[model samples]
Target: MVDKPVPDATRRSEKSRRAIHDAALALVAEVGYPKTTVEAIAARAGVGKQTIYRWWPSKADVLLEAFLDLGAQTARELGQEPYVIPDTGDLAVDLKAVLRATVDELLDPRFEAPARALAAEGLVNEPLGREFVAKLLEPQLRLYVDRLRSAQDAGDVRPDVDPRIALELFVSPLAQRWLQHTGPISYEYTDTLVDYALHGLAPR
Candidate 1:
């Protein structure tokens, strides 16, 4: 059987949701997360506060969804279908490609400011931090997990190596630099990370 068309009201609601997401990202980028309130998002989005509340309980919730949408948009912009990691049997190549894309995302001006602000907030606010990690970070990390597991199955990665731990060798360093300004973020830097993570820091 064929599916029916979406209702006009549903289409309008979706359009409003997109507007809200765009507004949330813009507000957070402009004003920081703490000052970005529901009323402000409503006004910027051209919707009522009740419209936002009908879909999300709070500003944090709206921002979270907005950030998730941003990730997908960024992925598409980078020529990646969101939430997927390539599993070419060559683990090094696959890892480098993903890391390079991540470096691009981290370096993007549109993403950097708001992400940094939210990250700083997450650092001091334990509950919010946990929510952010659980809602956004972990799911993204799991894509690496699945990719590494594929590599292990292909004998491209050591059987004894744990995918989750192995992934952090590349991911955490990039994350630290991006989140804390510990160092510069670049394609070459992430490429080196993929090498070091896969080939061991010592000899060989």
Candidate 2:
């Protein structure tokens, strides 16, 4: 008898994982976080509920990993490294570049809808909110903090300035605008934010 070809288990697993991530994101975007359950995600992904349970403990874990996968995929598509802040010698230019990328990501419909749903849910569900912050937001914020610290070392920022607080000057405003629909987010707007943040409003 002829030897049979071996099945590519890894490739099959990857396909299923991607499907699960996509399904979780879509479900959360369409139904909001509270209504997006593990069973729903598994059904939407065309995977057995047992498969989802085997991979993740809860719906929140599934959603978190899905967002993470989405971010990494987006970064690859953009030809940028995932979860990194650039460190060019010019602090203002570097900040503007990163923030401009952020603006693009925020405006992307694929990212926007699910992100808004999660943020809204986080507001009411304290435990989920904390998990979101701990798993996602805080790590991203640390990137900014690290970049700011480098700028400080180079004397681009004041030694007295707190990197943690300093980063919020630009990051918080952009987040607020995107989350609250208070204003349009554009590359130009983010560039202005970087400039104003690097150079005080009181003038040189």
- Candidate 1 C-alpha lDDT tens digits along 1-204: 998999999999999999999898888888987898999999999999999999999988988998898898888887798567887678888888888888888878878888888888899989998999999899999999999888888888899998888888899999998887799888888889888878887996
Candidate 2 accuracy as lDDT: 0.91
Alpha carbon lDDT of each predicted model? 0.88, 0.91
- The TM-scores, one per candidate, come to 0.92, 0.94
TM-score of 1: 0.92
Error of 2 at 163 (Å): 0.5
lDDT tens digits, residues 82-180, model 2? 567888788888888888888889989999999999999999999999999999999989999999999889999999999999999999999999999
Query: Where does model 1 exceed 4 Å of error?
Result: 1-7
Supply the global lDDT for candidate 1: 0.88
**Candidate 2 TM-score versus the reference:** 0.94
Worst 10 residues of 1 by lDDT: 82-91
Candidates in order: C-alpha RMSD to true structure: 2.2, 4.0
Evaluated at residue 119, the lDDT of candidate 1 is 85
